[model samples]
Target: MNPLAHLRPALDAGLVELGLAAPALSARLLDYLALLDRWNRAYNLTAIRDPREMVVKHLLDSLAMAPFVGDETLADLGTGPGLPGIPLALARPGLRVTLVESNGKKARFLREAVRRLGLANARVAGCRAEALDEPGAYDCLTARALGTLAELVRVGGHLLKPGGRLLAMKGLAPADEIAALPPDWHASAVHALRVPGLDAERHLVVVTRRAA
Candidate 1:
């Protein structure tokens, strides 16, 4: 059975239709997943052992956010296995993505993926997002299935620039999370996502800091 035969069509079609797929993007997605699977055995990089799940959850879910962020520098906080970070970077090569991971093992995997994939524009910061000296220095701060609304906003808020957004890939409507933000923060639309070939509850929460 050809692995790419069945899966490529839907993904390629979706990306092209949405204007997200670029040259070599699909190939890199395969490489990225292969590396993750290879390393997971030795390092436990991700919970989803099945490569197919990696495609649906990690790859597709991450790519789903591509259209939203659109051409900006992104910082992915607590990028455990590069869920949305790596895939997002692959989907849009023009975007400068920094994957922030505190655990040395996970960080190493991210760096390995970067080098192997030849992602010159991507960098992996093996440090806590809070410790990174540059505050609010990115056009967007992103996280996928990372934390509670408060915990997510609390840690990731500082990474976004003054007007930059925090894009959280969550399971359902982020109403509770949105309400938790101070009144000053703006809660943009919570767009529902329809990721091809995957049955998962997906939502993209766009947020900004509360004005003082």
Candidate 2:
């Protein structure tokens, strides 16, 4: 019996609420959850140990950004255990996702997850976001629970194409962070994400470079 089977009903309901309802997608997400649960036990990949909580925080929260993601190359900086990166790749097969992590252990897990999940659309970059040499390569970038907007752009801004955007996931609307953005960067939009079962505030900050 699948250990995560009991959590499927809630997950499916959450997917339906998010307008991403699909049988196969739900199954795959659950499989990924199971894998994450297994690895978390030994690797301590994440603090949310409860499977039900993982369904809410990890799967649903990550999928919340799906509608905003375009079918373009994306680099997920500071991707610890492939939060939105893996989930986004699984949800959008056409999307090419790079899971960028500096930690050796996390990178190893990312590689194994990619191989085990058969994620042909995803790859792992085991290096700091600043050290990644691929400038102007990605059409979009995502950093979840990474850092302040200024710090994130400082390290990963060079990776974006001229018109590329950074989708920074935060717990609440960050007005101060937006104000602190370096002169060259700006917040184009702020999207409120409603992750089912999670009552806490969630926001996606769409940041872009200023016109020269």
Best by TM-score: 2
Model 2 C-alpha lDDT per residue in residues 7-28, reported as the tens digit of each score: 9999999999999899988888
Candidate 1 structure quality by residue, lDDT tens digits, 73-142 = 9999888988788888877768899999999999989988899889887899989877877686799988
- When summed lDDT is taken over every stretch of 10 residues in candidate 1, the lowest stretch is 1-10
**Model 1 TM-score, all chains together:** 0.90
lDDT for 18 in candidate 2 is: 94
Model 1 whole-model lDDT (C-alpha atoms): 0.79
Assess every candidate by TM-score.
0.90, 0.98
